[model samples]
Target: MGWRIRNGMSISIWNDCWLLGFPVRKVTSSQSTQVDLVSDLIDMDERSWNIDLINPIFNEADIESILDIHMSNSNQNDILCWKGEGSGLYTNLLTKRVSISNFCPRCNQSIEDNTHVGRDCPYARKVWRLLDIRWSDDASNLCFKEWLLRLFMTHNKGKHICIAVTIWSLWFARNRIICEHQYPLFVAIVQKCRMYLRHFSIRTHVLAWWKPPLEPTTKLNFDVCFSYAHQKSCSGFIIRDSAGFVLGSGFIHTHHITYVFMAEALVILQGVHFAKDIGITRSTLESDSKKIT
Candidate 1:
C-alpha cells in the first residue's frame, strides 16, 4: 500500500489472491521452513522486493520466480539484515526507533530525522564547514534518500565517498554523546573523519595514500595513565623495542585540553622524541587508544 502511493501507481485492494504477493507474511507455526523463508527474504534483491510490493499482483510463486536464486541455507535463522546490531544502549544510540522522544539531541526543539543528522543539524553543518565543504541549506533540507541521490549525482567519486564518511562521522559523533555523554568539538569531528578515512584506506583498497605521512614507520607504545587535574590534562607515552622491551617513556602534559587529539599528538611527538632518544631510526607505533591511532 505504501509502495502504491510512493510511485503514484494505482492498485486494487479487493483481491485477496493479489495480497499474497506481499512479502509481509506470517510464517506457519511449527514450521522449521520459516528459517528458509526468512533466508529467502533476506537474500532477495532490493529491486525484486520493490517489484513484488509495487506490482500488487504477483503471487508467492511469482515472487519465487522473480528471485530464482539459491538459498545460502535451508535454515535461515542466521539470515539477517545489518546483523550484529541489537537492542541496547549502543543500538538505541545509532538508530531512531519509534518512541515518544523525537526532539533533536542538540537543539531540543526540532524533530530528530535522518536529514537533520545527515545535513541539516547545526552541529553537522559546522563539521561540514570545517572540511571546506559548503552545505546548501535548501538542498540538504530534503529527505534522506533524495539527499543521498543528489550527492551521488552532483559530486565526483572522491567527493561522494567523502560525503559518505561525513555522514558516518556525524552519526558516530552523535553516538559518542549518547553512549558517553561527551560532546566533541567540530574540529575533532572533522579530524576523526580524516583519521577514519586514512585507517579505512589501509584496511580496505580505497585510497592510495594520505598527505603529511611517512607511512607511520615509528610506533609509540603507550600504557600510560590518562588524567585531568588542576584544569590540565596529561598522559604518558612509552616506546618499546621489537621484543616488547621498554626503550624509554615520557610524560606529556596539556593545559585546557578536553578532547583526546591533543593527548594523541603529544604522545606521537613524544614517541618521535623517544625514537630519537633511544637511537632507533625506524619503528611502528602502537597505542591502547585504538580510536586515536
Candidate 2:
C-alpha cells in the first residue's frame, strides 16, 4: 500500500508508506527518536521539502523518491490505498471482476495467476531467458511470491533489481499485447528493464567528487563545450597532481565542426598533446561524455 499525503499531520514518518515503493518504518524507531510524524519532513511555511532535514536521514534514492512524490492539493485527509493494480485502487470486488479470465493471455495455456504470469507463462519465460536469468524446472512448483522471496534471499541488490524489474516488464508487456494489441520484442523488454535498473543504481550510488591519481602520476580531466551560435567548439582540460594540485590547464578553440563526436575526438587528441608537451609520461584521462569515454 501507498499513501497520498494531504494534511501530512496524521501520517507517521516512521510508520507510514508515504514514499512510493517503500514500506512503513523504513528506518527503525531506535535510530531517530525525534522524528515522528510526516509533517516533520515538510516545511509548513515554504510548502516544500525540508532537504536539510531529510538529506542526512535518507539515502539518495529515498530522497529523490520523496521529492518526486506529488502531494495532494485537495486539503483532504490523507489516503492509504493499495497501489498494486496500477490504478491506486485494489479491492476484492475489482479482483473478482478482473480474475474472470482464467487462461493465460500470452501463451493461451494454463490458468492465469501470479505464478503463471510471472514464471509459467511461455512469453515471460522467454524474456527471462533473453535476460540470461536462470530458472530451474524444479522451482516451477513454487508460487510466484515464494519464488520471488527465494530470489531476494539468494541474490545481491543488483540481481534483485533485475529480477523484480524484469517481472514487472513482462507483466506490462502482456497487458500491452492484450489491451492495445501491441507486440513488443523480448529483447526490448530486457533492455527496458536493464535501463531502469541502471538509472536506479545511478540515482542511489554515491561517488566522490574527484580522486587524485597515485604518486608521480597526473590526472587529466577533459571536456568539450560546443557553441551553436558560433558553429564551433572549445576543448578544455585540466591537469592535476596526486594531491589534486593544479599542474596545468588549457583550452583550444577548434574550427567549425559538423559532428559532436568529431569535436570530442579532436579535444581528446589535443588533451593528449597538451599532456605530452608538459613532460607528463604517466597520466590518466577522464571525460564526462559517455561516447568520448
Candidate 3:
C-alpha cells in the first residue's frame, strides 16, 4: 500500500510508501531523525518538495524517488491506496487462480489484463461503442483502474453508473464464455442492460442507493463480498419497494467459496428462495453476476 500524496501532512516521511514502489516503501538508510511527517519535507507555500531537507537524510535513490512524487497544489487530504493498480473494481480472473495464457478468451488478441477485459479488447470496445457512452481516445491505453478513474472524473453520476455497469457486464460476459462455454451475441447483452439502465434512478439523501422496482413489485439485489484473509465471505440480499423502502434484507456467512463468481451465484440462488419464503412472487432478482436472468 502507498499514499497518494496531496497535502502530505498525514503521511510519514520514513513510513508511508508515498514514493509508490513495491517490497519496501520506507527509506532504506537507517539514518532517522525528528522528521515524522512528510509535511516537514514539503514547501507548503510553493507546493513542492523541500530539497535541502530531503537530500540530507535519504540516499540518492530515495531522494530521486521522493522528488519524483507529485504534490498536488490543492489541499486535499493524503489518500492511502493500493499501489499495484489504479482501479480495484475490475477483477483479473487469472490473478485469483492458477497461471495460464494471458490472452483474452473473447478476442484471442492482446494479453487479458484487467484493462483489456474491462475496456480495451475488441469485444469490450464494441460494447462501449454500442452503449453510446463517449470515452477519451486514449481510453484503450490505460490500465483498468486508470480508465475507471478517468470515467468517474469526467462523467456525471448517471453516465458513470452506466459505465460501471457496462464494465461489470463485460466481466460477466467473459466468465460465461469461459465457464459455461456459451456464446451469445453482444447486442443481446447490450439490449438486456439497456432495459435495466432505463429504470435506474438515484434517490436523494438515501444511504442505501438502488433503483426502486415498479409498484407492487420488489427488487432483490444479491451480492457477496470476498475476504481471502479470513477464508470466508459474506453474502447478502436486500428487497426494496417501488418507493425504495426496505421490504426485507438478509445476510449470511459463506465459506469454502473458491471463486467469488460462484459465491455470487449461490447468493442469488439462496436469495430467490429467501424471497419466496416470504411469499413474494412478483419480484425482480438483481445481481452483479449475469449468471442468472
Write down the TM-score of every candidate: 0.37, 0.39, 0.42
Q: What is the C-alpha local distance difference test score of candidate 1? A: 0.50
Q: In model 3, where is the ten-residue run with the lowest total lDDT? A: 79-88
- Per-model CA lDDT versus the true structure: 0.50, 0.68, 0.69
Q: Per-residue lDDT tens digits of candidate 3, residues 223-279?
A: 777777766667777776777766556665666777766777777776666566446
Q: Rank the candidates by TM-score, best first.
A: 3, 2, 1
Most accurate candidate by TM-score: 3
Q: Number of clashes in every candidate structure?
A: 5, 0, 1
Q: Each model's RMSD to truth, in Å?
A: 20.7, 18.8, 18.1
- In model 1, the Cα lDDT at residue 221 comes to 60
Off by over 4 Å in 3: 1-97, 202-293
| Tens-digit per-residue lDDT, 1-293, candidate 1 | 11111111122222111122222222222323222322223324432234433234345554554344333212111111111122211133225443435666776767766677667778888887777665466666676777777777777766766787888778767655643356888788899888876766665643343222144343456533345554454555554443444445545444665556665656666556545544668877656565575
lDDT of 2 at 194: 81
Model 2 per-residue lDDT at 58: 74
Better of 1 and 3 by TM-score: 3
lDDT of 3: 0.69
**What TM value does model 2 have?**
0.39
